[model samples]
Target: MISAPHKSSGKTLVSLGVMYNLVQEGFSVNSFKKGPDYIDPMWHRLVTGSQCRNLDPFLMGAGNCLDSFISNSDEKSFSLIEGNHGLHDGMDVDGADSSAGLAELLETPVVLVVDSQKMNRGAAAIVKGMQSMPPKACIKGVILNRLQGARQEEKQRSAIERFCGVPVLGAIPKDDALAITERQLGLTTIDETADAETIIRNVGEKIASCCDLQAIRSLFSQAPPLKTSQVKAERKAIASVSIGVFMDPAFCFYYPENLEALAKNGAELVFINALEDASLPDVDGLYLGGGFPESFLRELSGNRSLLRDVREAARSGIPLYAECGGLIYLCSAAHYEGETYPLANVFPFEMGFQNKPVGHGYLDMKSVCDSPWFAKGERIRAHEFHYSKPFDSSEIDAYQFEVLRGFGVTGKRDGVLRGNLFASFAHLHAVANPGWARRFVALASDYKVKGRCAV
Candidate 1:
């Protein structure tokens, strides 16, 4: 397992670089993400040319972690598990539920990615504490990132090795070329980023030069043999349906597993851009994932043609599903910075930016209304992270459909679902709730077959 002291220490780049170099060296490598991140795994998949699965112990349980890891290992000789946030960062008191805890549970060896630019000997202290803390947390080696130069790199490397008693597996130089463009959600999705292949190759070259690729590969060989199973249950034939997926840079938050699940359950996906595209694709359903739509509110709002097209489609009974940024886009108006912009207006609501109402963390959703997304009384676990809040309570009340877990937007209420539109602030991973994609596809299938919305 690879972990960092904090976010943006080049963990993903280092992991992907190492994986790509290994694949180039003639090794069939598999990759797994530690938490609910969908963006990093896209780079992993691009580098390794394999489907990367997420292993969140909190959401999917410890058993599913091992299951997901083992199942994806069927076609590869080695597996790389990239962790999220900091090493010991988690949602529990005392950091007991952190990624380090999960590493201990899985008995996996961790390589610490330390940002060596700011600290000389202090970096060593952090590494030593991580290595010595709870000996059960098997931190094997350290990778010194953001090295200034040869002299600075040598000083930091020697300091870490001498003080921390851990081998410096790598020392990555400060290279602006290796930096990936990022917005609110995370790194720009591979699909939207230009020259993706060149970027990956450049990153891989830098990582290979700095890191001990051979040592990293050796660690993967130490992973215990994984077990596997197969279910022969026949897949139900889903009626023909097409789903319009928001794919522009502003709204590109989606789990690959989610899209795969929808396809596997028999729904064709049509990609559309919210920034440049003028109309939604001809489809039975529309899916608007999450991204930094607020930053592009002016551009999105100015695209009157696209906004009108989406509103018309929703009115025509097209099943529309949106999350976070997507939810904001469907609102009647969105207030950002100091200006207000008219949105799709599919839902009778307006959103305003707020400093105190920033929503974050895991959520449990309970369905209050029978909608195409979920059956009445169904409970689903999802993550919610945003800074905007609904401004008009009366308007929100007109379309409110689901309630959250005893918080924000009281008893039996959170998401806004009206007619064929299901919009929510919470973002979901299909693996967390395997039934979501199927239900979405089923609804779309119903609309396609009958020429009318399912709900």
Candidate 2:
């Protein structure tokens, strides 16, 4: 496990570097992120050439987290779990759902990445505290990042090893070139960053030269064998349905498990580029995942034909599911920086961008009305992170979900329903909600059988 005292401590860069280096050395690396994130996994996938799965205990539960880790890490030469935020930071006061807790559950040895910019022996104190804290992770090694000179590195390394009683595996020098650009969401997506590969290669080379790969591999070997279920559930066969997925730079925030679940339930995924595609494809259902549609406002708004096609599909009883950015795309228009960009207009509402996050973090919602996707009174555990909200509040009561926790479309409700279309700001994961893919596939199959009848 690669973790740190806090966020922005250069652990992500270290993870990417270590993974890339190992992959280059002919080791198959399986990566997992410890939260509901789509961006970091993109970089991980780019480096390892495999899907980076998420292991969120709060959203997916501890049992699911263990099962997922065991299943995905099986038969792989190397398994790396990257922690989010601080090792002990979590929604729970007891830190039961933090990355340290996850490390303890999996019995994985953690490599602490400490930012040694303004401190010398203080880095050791932080490491010792993290090691001694309740729900203590098996912190076996430490990596001093962003060091200035040999004197600074010597001071930190000696202090950490002497006090924390852990090996100083690496002391990475401070280099701005190794950093990935941050945005309102987080790191820039691999699709939009043209030099993403170059950055990964550079960071990997730097890590290979500085870090002790042999020691890192030794720690990985110390993890105890996890007891995983050998039995795989048999999937019931269903009529295959093509589901169009918006997968371009404008819409790329899809969880890998979500797509895999859809395929397992017999749905053929057809990728669609919302920014470039002139028209919709011949698919039974359309999936629009979360992404930065706000970034390409002019281009998306200028794509008049595609917008009209999407609106037609929604009106024609075609099963359409959209999250966050997808919800924005399906709206009438978006107001940003005093400019209005026309969108699909599936629902008669306009979206407006805010300086701060309008809806962020975990969400608990109960279905108020029956929709093609979710049943009435169904409880949903999902998450939302967005800066955009509906400009017009007249459609507040038209939603399907009664928000119990976190902000939704409004402070009260979310999950706007129109015909067979369901749009929301909350993003769902298939591992947590096993019925999501099944129900979505069933909905699409029903639509396919009934044909495109106008609602």
Best by TM-score: 2
Q: Residue 419 deviation, candidate 2, in Å?
A: 2.7
Each prediction's RMSD to truth: 3.6, 1.4
* Candidate lDDT (C-alpha), each: 0.78, 0.91
Q: Name the runs in model 1 displaced over 4 angstroms.
A: 75-77, 93-97, 105-107, 132-135, 148-165, 175-177, 191-199, 227-239, 354-357, 368-370, 375-377, 398-413, 453-455
lDDT of 1 by residue, 308-396 (tens): 98888888788888888888898899988889999998877688987644666777776766766777787776776677877765755
Counting clashing residue pairs in each candidate, in order, gives: 2, 0
Q: Show the colliding residue pairs in model 1.
A: 402-414, 403-413
Each candidate structure's TM-score, on Cα atoms with residue i matched to residue i, is 0.85, 0.97
Q: Highest lDDT, which number?
A: 2
lDDT of 2 at 442: 88
Per-residue CA lDDT of model 2 for 238-272, tens digit only, reads 64999999999889999898998999899999999
lDDT at position 441, candidate 1: 84
